[model samples]
Target: MHLAFLRDYHEALVIALARTRPTIERGTVAEITSLTPQAVSKVLTRLLDDGVIATAGVRRAALGKPAAVYRLVPESRWAIGAHVTRRALRLVLTDLAGTVHASATTALPADFTPDDLLGRLDSGVTAMIREHRLDDDGPRPLIGVGIGMVGPLDQATGTVRDAHRLRHWHDIPLAELAGQRLGRPVLVDKDVTAAVTAEAWRRDAGFRDAALIMVESGVGAGLWLNGAAHRGTHTNAGEFGHTVIQLDGPACACGRRGCLEAVHDRAADPAAAAAILGVGVVNLLQTLDLGHIVLAGADLLRHGEIYRQVVEDAVRTQVPRADWLTAEVTLTGLGTDVIAAGAAIQVLNLRYGLPDPVGLRLP
Candidate 1:
């Protein structure tokens, strides 16, 4: 069993490397992943048999014999990612390479219930599958569905413990419920965390410590720390909006006073809203010492330049010795579809992405 697990791990590691590079040879894979040549050969054989990868050609160097080169077959797997916001349900179809091939969005009913969401999800997924010609007959079948939702949820149990402002979500078993309804496996995670995962997957390894600050119907921060998603002990880590920024200030929907979301919502103008969000970003930077700050969400993207400038100014002016502790602040490259795309990538990661090497060290 241990050997089998390690074999799977090595296979995932090779696939991950192949996704980044144009072609991979056995020696290169072994060197980068610290896997033995024999192990790489075994993993490569299995991947080739499974059609996950294909031999590109032969590489011959001046010093050694020709070596077979392999590359990932990105279309070898597919997943559906759903972003369930307060206002809409956005879905995307992503391949193994984390590329969003097709996407669709539909408005949700005001204060939608669990039943309402499931109903729409069932129909939406069917339409997406049919429209994209994503049938089970393909070389890469649709594996599962991943949901990026409003949080205060338990990722471990796949339950929504209590989504802050959503009335119909309390200890809701979303993963199980959606799985049963759609007849496919399901994975659930906080929206911000999923958004950050998408950013990390797309940005290469340099985006180790960062925050995806989303400002849509509400505010939240998705944390990517030490090259992985950082969900707190209860998986409720990205509740940035509820953080008390003003004592005895306006009452927030979460039953908190002077929350960052509340203050930003009550701001008189877009500039004021951006400034409020900027202060929150500074607080996150102080706590995490992040390398990147990605601003996203439907509401924020509407005024993208403003939010980007304000947050960049805050990081430059508010943080001490800004030159010494520079943090890159920019808008999300994926825009409003980030969370949904990330959710899809989360599904792919669960199945094929390599585990964090840091977590694999012996105690």
Candidate 2:
């Protein structure tokens, strides 16, 4: 119960801070949350005492008493993020202020098994910890970990249900294996989902409800809402690649004709701007009602203009809903390295705590 309540209160505090930027009066926080002024005062006091927030100065209304304002301390704790792909793995340790502290990567064989991947992950974590100069011993009581990997992921089971990029891979035990080995809570998300998570956490444009679409080696999308990934009933909500976009477009490996994946084949179609892309984007955007679109992943970037033009053109023509027009589309901030940054950031988060300036307390 304490844990649950702490999490809820933490979220409430985080939401309030995010919406208002750095500094806010206790009264203002109360007004935004519709909570009693006294309650807000208590939370603020705790935040200040714990160093999560700090008092800045006195604010004076035209004819009122001076006000004490609180702001996110700017640096509190930090997080590690990791992104895993068929060819390589990337990791980064970040400070609470969205600053990258350390980073590294290693090549991954296309035929590696789940066990093989986990072994590399263990080695990577140990190396990252050492590189980060984590305390005299190591990190303890970490925040959380977020992982980005090739999907169809079973979030509940922490398994990769089926990944085409890796040879003979299905139902790979990723979450359980990593969590057990690392001794920290692990969050499993598809590459796009983890990218969205990182994007939201690091940027002002992050959606209260949003979607991230990656057209890389494999086309996949990730869904995030209310500051967390919406893994859905079956935890397979964003498998848009499997949805049929063009009934007779092309044959998919799933033994289907015209699935989004087949239509958006990055390698075969040098020109990714064919009619098939329009159908997929239009169908996906309308159904998701997402307010923003982050176009990322390596394959799409490789094609560059071809990829963007197809998506933008499709969105313009297919989306009849006026509200959908406002959905902002932008290239990922980190571009092709987003997954790697996201992955490394996830590990850092586990070591430090999301946005906690205290990061891993490297010796």
Candidate 3:
């Protein structure tokens, strides 16, 4: 059983080591993965046989002996990720190790239907796969399709509950529909939640616990806790942008008045949402006590400094117990590509049979 656990961790380690520096020696992999030298060699042999890795070259190290380096082969299977936002659909294709290979974005027509979107997404993936010459039907290179969409999704039914922008999109079967068209299994999730899942396994800061708040065309958040992403009951727990802030403020497109989205039109312009988002975000800071709220998406990053200042001020004012809620509300390092990168991460995770982020129900 212990070896079983190490077995999974070992595959992930080899992929990680091969990616970090493009090439790695056996001794270096041992240090990074914390596995013994002999154990690392055993794993390397298995990986090479699987065609996931290949030997780069041998280098003389000052410590003990010379070591052979390993690199990721260019042709190990791939996973496809799709992001359907208000006006456009973004696509990302990546390898088993979650490294992106090709990406494309297409504008979505205003009078589009669920069927229309599915067709476009399917064709996009097909064209991209063929263009990249990555199809061989060897072992199912395409793991699955992951979608990052605007939400209030019913996980059980895989339906889109009322969306502000996608008024025509309601209770539509996304995963099954897309799956039928693409000939693969599909995972549909909120865009922000996907972002949270993508960012949690950061090799840099290594923040295992954090919250990702995105003030975009809509506002939402993805929470990461205990090395897992947290989704609440109904899978829409992080719907903060829609929470009512003003009962009599402005009529939201969703038919609500003074809601976080009503006053904050971050989608219209990110600078606008900063004020309204700050009001409630401060309250959440003191309540969750979890540090590191990530401000991502197109809108928030547009007026990043303003959003940062407003949230920071609110934290200082509301969380009187601390100077700044004891957390850092920041931006995502991935920029616009996050949606695709995150989706790719989801694809790899599902392939490896890893646990879904905490709080997300497995429907």
In angstroms, how far off is 308's CA in candidate 3? Answer: 3.7
Q: Model 3: how far is 134 from its true place, Å?
A: 1.7
lDDT head-to-head 1 vs 2, winner:
1
**Residue by residue across 165-255, what tens digits does model 2's lDDT show?**
5775677777877888878667676677667656766665346567777776667777766555666776667777888866776788778
Q: What does candidate 3's lDDT look like per residue over 1-363, in tens digits? A: 887876877777676556546687787788877899998888889888878788888888688677787887745767787878888899988676555678899988885789779989988989987787655467446666788888878654556786557767887878778878888777787787778767764433356567788866777788776666666677676878777877778777767787786678733554546766777777567567777778788867877788888777776666777664477777787777677767767766654524454524323
Instruction: At residue 105, give the lDDT of candidate 3.
Output: 94
lDDT of each: 0.88, 0.65, 0.73
Instruction: Give candidate 3's total backbone clashes.
Output: 1
Could you tell which candidate, 2 or 3, scores higher by TM-score? 2
For candidate 3, the 10 contiguous residues with the lowest summed lDDT are 353-362
Model 3 bad stretches (over 4 Å): 1-6, 13-39, 56-63, 67-77, 96-101, 136-140, 201-205, 253-256, 266-272, 309-318, 321-325, 352-354, 357-363
Candidate 1 lDDT tens digits, 6-42: 8778887888788878899999888988889998999
lDDT for model 3? 0.73
Backbone collisions counted per model: 0, 27, 1
Error in Å for residue 220 of model 1: 0.4
